[model samples]
Target: MPRDAEDRRLEPFEWNSEESVRYEVAIEVIGEGVAHYSALLNAAEAAGDEPEAARLRAEIGACVEERYRLRATDHEGVTQVLHKYRALLRAPGDHDA
Candidate 1:
């Protein structure tokens, strides 16, 4: 399935400027971390690995905190980036705001 540009995730290079670049990089990194940990958490849960799942959950929480921090300090339109990645971070049967 092809995704529309408006519906796609934000990239670091989409905005130009040193601060914007750094901000975007930080946001993207946090988003990626959340995604990676979420995947691992799912796998661990599927395998009944409680310890690993717990660790991954902590990591995902940290990423979410970082995402919130970045969003707090961002300029206009940063929520667009946040929502894009938040969708990826959300798990099945979970509804977080």
Candidate 2:
């Protein structure tokens, strides 16, 4: 199936500056980390391992904390809130204009 405009994960970039590209890459890296740990967290929960799940949740919380340096994330329990964090990637003015 073909994907629509909204299906795109990243916005179009015209390769303006090195700093901007690097900043965007950093955001993507954090996002990938989130995805990775979230999957492991899910697996841990499915296996009925609370200890491992808590560990992964902490890892995820740390990654999320770094991703949003301005705001702290108080992640409570197992949440499927990954989608909500996607907007954080674009909201930060981390790049130099």
Candidate 3:
């Protein structure tokens, strides 16, 4: 029997459980860190504060390292969230995703 188009189109959310929610929160933290780092970099550039910029850059690097360390030990839920966030970040011309 041919499946209904609507039924075929209805896909379950990849992360819909409580654990997934926690993972999502972690991913959001990582994203926020990225945004903060980017803003600091921009501000440093605008103000021509090379030293401050260097400091912020180091902080950003540390945050990234921490994120990866957590990810390495995270459960399946976190891994799923990380995968989705990475895909969105790497997507072209659409940062809102």
Q: What TM-score goes with each of the models?
A: 0.53, 0.55, 0.53
For model 1 the TM-score comes to 0.53
Screening candidate 1 with a backbone cut-off below 3 angstroms (N, C-alpha, C), the clashing residue pairs are: none
Give per-residue CA lDDT, model 3, range 8-72, as digits (tens). Answer: 74446454477566765776867765776678688988999998788777767865665555532
TM-score of structure candidate 3? 0.53
Error of 2 at 19 (Å): 0.6
Off by over 4 Å in 3: 1-16, 72-97
Alpha-carbon lDDT, every model: 0.64, 0.56, 0.63
Off by over 4 Å in 1: 1-16, 71-97
Writing each residue's lDDT as its tens digit, candidate 2 over 4-97 gives 7444534464544654544555556677767767777888899999998988788788877766652112232111223334443345522111
Off by over 4 Å in 2: 1-16, 70-97
Model 3 sits at a Cα RMSD from the real structure of 12.0
Question: lDDT: which candidate is best?
Answer: 1
Tens digits of per-residue lDDT for model 1, 48-96: 9998888778878866765765542465446555565556556453323
